[model samples]
Target chain A: MIDIALTEEQRDCLQELINVAMGQASDKLARFLNTFVHLNVPNIELVNFDSLPADFTENYAQQNLSVVSQGFYGNEGIRGESLLIYKVNTLDDVAKILGYEPGEISDNEQLTDISSILTTTFLNGLAELIENQLSYSAPRVVSSATSSLDDHLKQLSFDWDLALKVDISYMVTDYSFDCDMVLLIPGEAVKNIQLVLERILKEY
Target chain B: MDLPQINQFLVKEINVGIIVIDAEAKVKFINQFVLSNTDLATDYQEQSLFNLFPELPEKWLKRKIESVFTLNTPAFTSWEQREYLFKMRHTRPITTENDYMAQNCTLLPMSNNADNQPELLGFIIEDATDVCFYQKQLSQTVEKLEISNRTDSLTKVANRRYWEERLAIEFERAKRHNQPLSLIMFDLDKFKNINDTFGHVAGDTVLIEVAQNVAQNLRQSDLLGRYGGEEFAIILPETDAEGALVLAERIRLGLAMHQIKVDEGTVIATLSLGVICICDDYSQYEEMITRADMALYQSKRDGRNRTTLYQA
Candidate 1:
């Protein structure tokens, strides 16, 4: 496995980039759902595939989650998969926003729709700032409400040994609706991202 | 370059519906599949998609398409997620179950040249009716299996194994919160005599009737389970010794008054119940069960058809 690490400067730059991206994404979501979307500070981590399950379980083991995943690729080796993890308990609020009766089918629909909106808006904003033109695969419902994050993470077949994991959480202001968007840039993509960060840092 | 004709033929002949719309969601190009599936006439070019299909979720679809255009990426919706984007009849012969086709749709950004930004959006609607049909059946079977696994086949209440698991969990929760929890253990009076004289089938009928009667009398939060042959147990969370004794007496009296008609003749049953409430000395749930059993023994010794509260 290749060793991947980000300097304090690089991490700070990436964090700043994610903050701006999250703001743009939340604004779009607020307009669409007519609800104030609260944003959390983006957490950046370098994760190994072996310890990924343990890391995920530490925070989300107790939660039943429905996850939507989409893959994106761009020039200069900029590629990663974005996961939108929705707590099953919060699906009722999402169903209300979508104007549907809360049930299994409606829950899955709301998860998919909201995930798509968040993933595209956030990734597009980040891609623009980084000067990379990225294209995404269709967003897919990867895990249902019956599964936990630990189980889902264990089942994943990761081709990359290491990943730059970025975590951002969104909470609806009044309602109990909360979700997390995680971006995993794997292996060589980390190096590519670092070079872009360094260039941005140099310009500063 | 020579494959343009083939490409055109492939696009038109494909089973899936393909449509290309500009930023305004007006149809720039539409294939034969979409045309055949819908009730539209010949002149459909330049028409807004919402005008073409009045049933479309205009606000949501427009936003989705706009997102794809802005991000230059594909977006997908499965039948399980939203059923279908357009209300089209499925070509499948069996149409009794589903009224409209189940669809999995993909929206892609389309660009004429490699270097230019995407100017149009392409929509591909694939028929997912067969997949959806099989998936629903599988889930239904799974749900039924899950329920049966935790339920007793004879009584339809929770089986001994599942009941014990709940008991352990509730016991720990009670200990942590220092809350009152009660357990009632009971058996039908002279149940063995009924099986010997009226046969096992009659005994089964008696057990079923007794289970139904007890279940109907309990609160929603209480769990009743068949613990052993002719023996049943109840777990009452947030209930004290007095509450447990009251429920036990209700069950005992209710059964003694009602007559169960088996194949042989009418049989009146009675119960001997042992009740135990949570105390500091009782560290584990097994200890509570043992004490409750001891109290049940006392009830049996002092004659049947009575409730005995364990003195912890």
Candidate 2:
């Protein structure tokens, strides 16, 4: 297995860049929904593909979850996937905010809507910072309330061994709605991001 | 033909509808597929898309297109999410249940030839009616399978595995909330005699009638399951000893009064039930079930067609 880890300087620089992108995403979400959004500091880690299912189950088991995943590809070999995870129970509140009636189809629509906004805005912001042009695949609901995260993760076809994982939480103010957005940059993309981070750090 | 002409020919011949629009939502170019598929006119060259399709969800579509312009990336909508972006009829030979054609639309940032910066957006709409139809059918089949997996085919009640799972869940909830809960175990008196005299079919009919009668007498919250051959169980939430005994007696009397019609002849069947209410001494649902089984055995000993509540 090829071992790849981000250095301390690269990690800090990447974290700072992610913070700015996440802030832009939250602002766009706030304007779109007409509600204030609170964002948590993003957590970054390098995880092995084999351990992903167990790690996902350990963090997000027992409770019902809905997950949406979208792929993004960019210039200079920058590519990754973005996953938006929402608790099943909190979808009703989110539906109300999006002016949708409480039902299964509407709940899915709400998830798709919010996921599109968050994924595109956040990735575009990051791509701009790195001076890379990125295009996206359509967002698809990977799993709904009926399936477990472990089962869903186990079935995913991962071509890479190691991935740089970034987790960000978005909580709507005065609402029982909070979702986690996880971005996974796999294999060569991690090295590419590290190189970009080094370049930015040198400039500073 | 040159590259631009070949590209134009391919775009026009493509099965999907492609439309190029500027930031103002004015139509710069629309392919033949879109015009041929929908009622839209060929004269919609410079007209606004919203004007041509007045029923369009202007607010949502505007935001979706604006996002692509701002982010310089592709945005997508699936039939599962929004049903359709454009309300057009499907031309498939097979009859569909949907009123309008289902669509999956993608909006991509199109760069100008002079500069590499994105100046216009391209919309590709794919007919997803067949996909939607197949997906609905598949989900319906899966739902039926799930229900069958949890239900007993003989008695049309909860099966053994599903009942035990629910019992465990209810047991934990009652313990946590300190709420009263009850379990009842019962079986037909001399069930094998009927199977021996008439046949297994007669026994099955009796079991089905008994299950239907008992289900009618129980509350909606109560769960009845076919535990095994000739044996059944119930989990009643928020029920004390008195309520449990009353329900058990009702079930017992209801079955005793009804005559089950089988292929051979009408048969009278009776049930001996054992009932138990939750108490501090009980730690698990299985223990309560064991006590209920013992009470049911006591009912059989004291003659059949009776309800017996477990003491302590």
Candidate 3:
């Protein structure tokens, strides 16, 4: 990672900005599902692309992941990708909540559809709170092999110098499903994001 | 005024099954095609997609349908993963195998009516069993072809070509791990004399019988191959010179004890053997085989039925 440092205040401010945006998205999702979503404190890390899986999943192995990715381009010259990572095991509680019974037709299609919707809504919400009209592309599904997580991340085709990793964890109320979402911003976009944060700080 | 036939009217009556479920996963409707093909009950209206099918993945169904409701788009799956979404069974013509029918399924989000009713999820199921069956048969045929290429027709053992390839792989592995490796090469003793006196048929019987005897005496890890017309080779991985010689002696003794029957009478045959270990001084795998060859020549010169080991 390029060793650009963030002051303690800057980190705290960025975290707060993300927290508020994600909280709104969570509320919207909760309304749609008719359930509460538990959110964890969003943490930041500086990591290289090659070491992403190892650095990201410090406590977990490469389990089955359904990744929904959306790349948003900002009018303020900041660009980033947001990934909603589902552990796949959470789908059962989700299905039951959706009025599906104990036995039925497969919900594989349903899982992909849900992945796309939740990811897009959550990502677009974050883009809006940043005060930039970030255009989000259609979400794409990546049911990648769990064994070679790094290889799949390497093949992402983005020549990003550094990744500002934002880790978010959420769970559905009364459901066993808990999932992680990540925001990967490039090094060049950091300057633009800081400027945006500065403007918000001056106004507030 | 009569209206022209639209795609919806044809799709409902087509052989494929069409079913619709709501965002709450309750079965909204089942077309005639779906009702006739599967054992789907008529009391499906407002029934949970889970309790109606009772065999499908409930959570997977919810995920797909929920995503459809959220994304307002279509999603798809085929016979490759779970074979069929339904438990409908059918017979395959080629293999005479009776199993679940293979199917390709598409799920599309349906817009609500102008009356402001809730939106529904649409599922189109197409039978794809025949294509799946043929794909399995082709892969089985390709596996048989692969086995044929690696086997020897004469002795029913690994052919020389396969043996050579395996030897190179083992050679590098042994060197890298500092493990012991040995090679044993042997030939039927007085094989030309037996062919001249008793005829070539008797000679052929003796060679077949001897190969089987040697194979029986070998360890499971040892690879036995027909090196040439009358010469056989064994690749012993993680075996020292002494271990190879001991195995070779068992083969030589087994061949001496066994008797083969020709048309005229019974014929007895003996074998000569050589064993050599891979040493640090050796540059390549071929050098180890050469040392075993030198010892084989020594064994034949000393007499016909004994085993010889090259010290250096």
Best by lDDT: 2
Model 1 regions lying over 4 Å from their true place: A1-43, A61-66, A72-80, A86-111, A121-137, A141-146, A157-160, A168-180, A184-204, B93-96, B113-117, B168-180, B258-268, B279-284
Residue B149 miss distance in model 1 (angstroms): 0.7
Worst 10 residues of 1 chain A by lDDT: A98-107
Q: How well does candidate 3 score on lDDT at residue A141? A: 58
Fnat: each model in turn: 0.37, 0.46, 0.06
A31 in model 2: Cα distance from truth in Å? 8.4
True contacts kept of 2: 0.46
Better candidate by TM-score, 2 or 3? 2
lDDT values, one for every candidate? 0.82, 0.83, 0.73
Q: Every model's Cα RMSD, please?
A: 5.2, 3.7, 9.5
- Cα-based lDDT at residue A138, candidate 2: 79
Reference-based lDDT, residue A81, model 3: 75
Clashing pairs in 2: none
Model 3, stretches more than 4 Å misplaced? A1-204, B1-4, B71-74, B91-95, B112-118, B197-202
**Using Cα atoms with residue i matched to residue i, what is each candidate's TM-score against the true structure?**
0.78, 0.87, 0.60
